[model samples]
Target: MEKARRAMFFLLLLIADFSVAQDTAGEADEFHVGVILDLGSLVGKVARTSVLLAAQDFYTVHRNYSTKLVLHVVDSAGSDVQAASAAIELLESYKVQAIIGPQKSSEAVFISNIGNVTQVPIISFTATSPSLTYNSMPYFVRATLDDSTQVKSIAALVQACGWREVVAVYEDTDYGRGILPYLTDALQEIDVRVPYRSAIPSSATNETIMQELGVLIAMQTRVFIVHMSSIMASLIFTKAKEVGMMNKGFAWITTNGVANIIDSLNPSVIEAMEGVLGVRCHVPRSQELDNLSIRWNRMYQQDNPYESPFNKLSIVGLWGYDTIWAIAHAAEKVGISSARDKQPWPTKSSTCLESMVISTNGPELLSVIVQNKFRGLSGEFDLTDRQQLKVSVFQIINVVERGWREIGFWTVNGLLRKLKRDYSKKTGQASMLDLNPVIWPGESTEIPMGWEIPRVGKKLRVGVCSSEFTEFIKTYKDPITNATTASGLSIDIFEEAVKRLHRPLSYEYLEFDTADAPISGSYNDFVYQVYLQKYEIAVADITIRSNRSLYVDFTAPYTESGVGMIVPVKENVNTDMWLFLKPLSTEMWFGSIVCFLYTGVVVWLLEHLIGNEHVHVPFSLKQLAITIFSIFEES
Candidate 1:
């Protein structure tokens, strides 16, 4: 009986093994997804980890699904050519249906072109240059918000703070240049002028950054908008602090690139970036997100045991996490494996000349992905018509002593109070009062005037034109005191205008004249001096003409609009017969004589007809006219 039971058990095990083999063969369909990233970069590392974790989590939830997602990640090594090469290899060799990444905007440009030719979707979470739009490359989808969308928010901040002039300090790469036109347009809409643009190269040294900082410090504009990666921004602020440019009068603002990475920075880096304001994507807190955060930290720590814990996840990582799910859901929605196999995958030799390998299911998968909408780690997962994230809310944070603090929220409508539950349900205005009080540079609570005249070291070199007419502008030297003084109408007007400024200004009056008496240059030459930067500004009786205005800017004229003519009035000395008729024309004199005769006849006729006792029948017509005239004079 025992031998018979053992034989039955072996038979049952053999039958179960055969059934499991058949089941595994039936579910052999694997969807190959490729990832192109610079794994050496901070953002790239986070992205790679996020995507790996997402795939793990996705399979765990949908273990019974028909197809499984197999990720084939390739390191681009932070080079554009390497990124493109990696993408081509994945498409031709691995037959990947979708690609995520090539973190930089420049890298994405080349890789996205390859994706278009291959009919594959190139989804990028951090390549935010506005130039990478879906209009040109239909297969390119921006999983993250475009950098252009945030320019309006930055402009609103500048407008709300009453900054009349702003200077943009950004990297010289495509990531920096792409958003400049949009930023300028937005600022122009709010009547703010971008006086200067300081473009620093990505590989610029400390000395170069300091040189740029020095140039900005000497400028009159104190409000600066810094748009660059976190590393470069840290260097800039460090140099700014060293030069005393990050003091009370200075204002610094950054974009999402630097802002989103603040939590992961070292304390020393954070210290260098103290009092900097930044705009970051607002990710609403949720239970699922919290759970994911915990799981991600554990997995990340286990994977990278030597590195420190990040403690916080950026939107870039969150977008990566959600992108994998989006692709998975889209792939599962179209359950036909024949759809992916219908189009022939090209070989290395076949695509050597053209590099074209069309994916049969690319369009359908993209359609489903575009249509897919759900609450994701980075808020709502919806793509706009432009194939970019449909996010509107952005948080304005201030870098303080203990990491960053949320000061306010900015949306398409305007700025709002600190974001909370159901915050999107309410609308708000772009007013400073709506936001929490910000501790600006120098740890001051007061709002900066946004401009300052260097108090300690530098003085404005004001150019004053020496005039032949001393009444307009007179410069004299005291014989004994050896002191220079300037006085006159022009000087008074300049002083009064300076007094009316929002803040105090220190200026030294520099008379632009030879050792001789009066200035020799024309008004046009005098104004050109300002353009050449020989002097900060010129104060004189400078006539504003169209030609002069083309070379340099001019303030509203302090004097009258046009020239005034002054002439003496002569006494009237006419001794002719027609002199009496000078006041009344000759026609008027003739008409008055005829009117008297007609009035006399009419008065005599009326007196006879009415039979007035005062005017007897024997009364002459002239006498009746005189009586009528006397009555007219009295009444």
Candidate 2:
């Protein structure tokens, strides 16, 4: 009886195994997709996890779908050449219908070319250089906002803070340099000037970065706009803090590239970045997003245990998550297959890249991806122009403590106190005050002036005139100290003007007199001293002559110096025919005579029309004259 029972159990197990195999064979078709990323980098690690999670969650929600995306990830290891190589390998070996990333813009350039040739869709969620556009590469699609799209918001912030000029500090790479032209043009539209551009190579040493920063410190501009990756930005801020550039009277603004991933920075890096203002792509919060963030943290921690525990998910990760959903949806619509039909190459070549087959369903898939619209984890995801997703809003953030705080939000219209509010015409345009109060560098609440008097370790040279007329400019010397003191109207006026400046002005007076020379130079030579750069400015009782105006600018005369004419007045009136005309000017006399004639003509016409007695006069001239005399006498 025991042997028979054991045989029946073995038979049941065999039957179950056969049924499981049959069900797996009849499951949904697997659609192969490739993902290329820098697995060693922070963004790479976060994005890879998000992409995996998105794929798993998508299939679980839509199990009835006909197709499933099977992702094949490759580690480009942060190299452009490697990215391109990985793309070729995926296209030839795996025959992937779509490729997700080549993290950096510099890497995307080469990989995108590969996709164009293969007729496969290349979707990048983090490569956001404005130089790469849809019009040029139709097979490439950007799931992220272009770096140029945030320039207007930067310009608006500059304008609101009343900064006249700014210096742009960027990495000397394609991704860093791509947004400069657009940034310069946007600032110019608001009447702001970009005085200088400071480019630092990605491979530059700490000493090299310090040398470059030292040059910026000697300039007059105190405002700086930084555009670079998070790693490079961390080094910049650390150096800036060391050099005292992150103190009071200095302003810094960061582009979205750095701001989006600020949450993932190390605690030490965050401390160095305190009191910095940033603009990031706004990701609307939802229940689904909240749940994803929880799962993402768990999965990321499990994968990367050595990374900082404080590191949190950022918008870049969210973009990576949404990007997969978009591709998966498009793949299903196009009825993609792992074994897609490939067109024969015209001629076989030596290189694998040249000999790769073109995907027949690539163009159809590209069209579907661009036209796909849905509310994603990172807000509304729509790639309308096939180049980039439309970005209408950006969140303004301020780095503080171990994290950052939301100050306000920027929209297409302008800055807003709240993201969603009643926008009347009068209240549409918000000023800097609309944003929450900020604690600037040095932990001060005062807004920076954005400009400073150049600190060149020397006082300004102000040349004063030593004239015979002590009332205008007088010089007194102290016998004990051998110090020369300037007094009088011009000296007092010039000193008062200096006091009214936004910042303190330090200057030393040098008398332009014969104390050092045999003979005193004329006023022309004194003003010419300024033109020769011997003196930064000249203060004296200077005349506003046209010749003197050519060399140096002169302030408007505070005290009058020109000659005034005085003539005798004749009060006695001579009795003559012109004496009556003296009361009214020549034009007024003519005007009064014309008015009297017009009044007389109108009265005469009225009497004739009404058949009054004034019309019975046979002589027309006599009647007109009588009417004129009567009207004038009545007036």
Query: For this target, which candidate reaches the highest lDDT against the unseen true structure?
Result: 2
RMSD per model, one decimal: 7.0, 6.6
Could you tell me the lDDT of residue 549 within candidate 2?
88
**What residue pairs clash in candidate 2, if any at all?**
none
Candidate 2, residues 556-579, lDDT tens digits: the string is 789767679999998886978777
The C-alpha lDDT values of all candidates are 0.81, 0.85
Which candidate tops TM-score? Answer: 2
Worst 10 residues of 2 by lDDT: 422-431
Give lDDT tens digits, candidate 1, residues 137-240. Answer: 88888888889888878988887788888999999899999989999999999888998999999899999998888788888789999998766887888888
Off by over 4 Å in 1: 1-28, 339-357, 384-386, 419-430, 454-459, 463-474, 478-483, 487-502, 512-635
Reference-based lDDT, residue 524, model 1: 67
Scored by Cα lDDT, where does model 1 land? 0.81
TM-score of every model versus the real structure:
0.78, 0.83
Q: Estimate the TM-score for candidate 2.
A: 0.83
